[model samples]
Target: MTGGLEWAVTTDGQAVTLRQVAAQAGVSRQTVSNVLNAPERVDPATRLKVRAAIESLGYQPSRTARSLATRQAGLIGYCLARHPGRSLFTDPFLHALTEAIEATGRRLLVFTAPEGAEGLATYADLIAQRAVDAFILSDTVDGDPRHGWLASRGVPFASFGRTWPEQGEQPGRWVDVDGAGACAELVRGLHSAGHDRIAFLGWRDPVPVGAAKDRQRGWRDECRRLGLPEQAAYADSDSMEGAAHAAATLLDAAQPPTAIVAAGDLLAVGVISEVRRRELRPGHDIWVTGFDDSLLATSVEGGLTTVRQPAAEITATLVRLLDAGPGRSGVLLDGRIVSRSSAPLDL
Candidate 1:
């Protein structure tokens, strides 16, 4: 006997029921269920007894039945952005977010949806079908409509990016990395290395919004604060090809910057490529830095210096906000600069 209960072997391949577990533990069916669902409400002795009875009877609660009873689907919905030539699986942040959600005993349900009206429709459809308990949003932009749609309908949701004030006065709960702060920190590092001529290569958003804008703002603000010329800033597509062309423009200028800070790793790679093509060495001739600390950043010959987002912490905080429900204040976590040969900083 274990835990003062005899372990019983189920016969004839019949599934053990809650009633059987209650009978074995000398408790009522309600007591057994309380132990399973809300153990805090049950005393330690009774809870242990019910747990022992459950193990001995080999009882497994039906998820479908539990959902019906609790009105929770035990699923968190996430809408995958269908960006052309981009796979969501390649992003480490998504991997961390997935693992964090599963750690909470909840599964992530991902569905692809195009941006705009169709994406909103997909969210509505998921709610209509009762396919999810709540949602986790990412890639949020200024004046995003999804947050308002979810909030107005009284749905519970948390975002991985900030729901900008353009969306409304009271944006939904969110967790976002401080892109501006990360970029400003990068600038400070470069300045500490005695490089005054600094340039910024950032994504060209149709509207001045999102992370790219924030990062650019940081570079601009820091440069002005240090009295460094900020005229070297340029905006281009997030692709390597676009960044390479933009880097070429900056390099060919009359007064080129000694160091360039790209908004992302891919853009930094482009700058490095352009720098090498012109018979210039990265750390020797021109200092380079990037954000995201992605695989490409590490794969570079000298390990590109970049900003590392706190993916695990961001996801954990997102889960906490979701658990707390809507109307919770947002969280903005800082990113750390990972120093390397590209732009070594005496951290």
Candidate 2:
């Protein structure tokens, strides 16, 4: 146990060690370490073989061993409590992001922390434990305290949503979909279709989320520029029921909107429901569009026209930025508008 044995399989069959994994993969101990730590430096075929061997042997490296060798944990931290239901796995975008990150060979260290002081304490504990080399911050909002806390600690971190400039001297390394631009395009198309009154449905929270603000900004700006009547509605939550109430308000207004553009798919679904309840046709009597192009977008009677965020691309960019270290400009990937029966395609 004290010699330079590097690794050995235990008689209890409780764990697989590096030495046994190397033997199985036909590689040396150093090769296995390189494969685990800096896989880019390892040959493709060799890395594949080593990974296959590790999987077959059910091998999991000791955190202490890894830290002793590389002085860093081969883990990426992510927070999930900020989402609607605190279930990241249930959301397709978050799920895709998690899968893409894991596909690169790094394991995730997910933590659920309530907002404010409690969340800070949770993050501090994770850092103190050296649980991860860096973190991926998602569901960012304006004046996010997590940014200041992590930056003050000099921890390597990147955001899946863009941070405001006021949060830092420069918006930190992050990747986000161009929600504003995409929403603007959706509004422009609706306006061209002779829809004079377009309503916006979005989150009604006091603390504005960066992504949601950008989306609303795009909708408002485009409407003002086109001399269209802007009707903005907000929902206290992202659920279809909340959206339905908001959409109903817009529908029952003195001058109802001919089209609806929601900040997210759930809100858009709510608008579709209201249209259906009133026996109005979507993509004809009232055009509707939403962001994220979630599963519900296609599940509806007339598929909702929505903006499709490239989750895989966003995850890949975030990983690259995190690997390169700090001071990188934020990335904004375009979300293509998927025209469907919910929104008209003409013009």
Highest lDDT against the true fold, candidate? 1
Report each candidate's C-alpha RMSD, comma-separated, in the order given: 6.1, 5.1
User: Which lDDT tens digits does candidate 1 get at residues 1-347?
Assistant: 12212223454687666678889999987788777655667899999888888776677565676688678898999887667334222377778888888777678999888786668989989999999989999877777788889988988999887656553364678888898998888888889989898999976657334777888889999999999998554545667888889888888889898899998888888889889999999987999998888888889998999988888999899899888866857788999899887887777
Task: Provide the overall lDDT of each model, using Cα atoms, as 2-decimal numbers.
Answer: 0.80, 0.79
lDDT of 2 by residue, 62-165 (tens): 55774677667878898874656522223766677677667676777888898765688888888898888888888776667786678777898888775564
Model 2: lowest-lDDT 10 consecutive positions: 1-10
By summed lDDT, which 10 consecutive residues of candidate 1 come out lowest? Answer: 1-10
Task: Return the top candidate by TM-score.
Answer: 1
Alpha-carbon runs more than 4 Å astray in model 2:
1-63, 86-90, 165-171
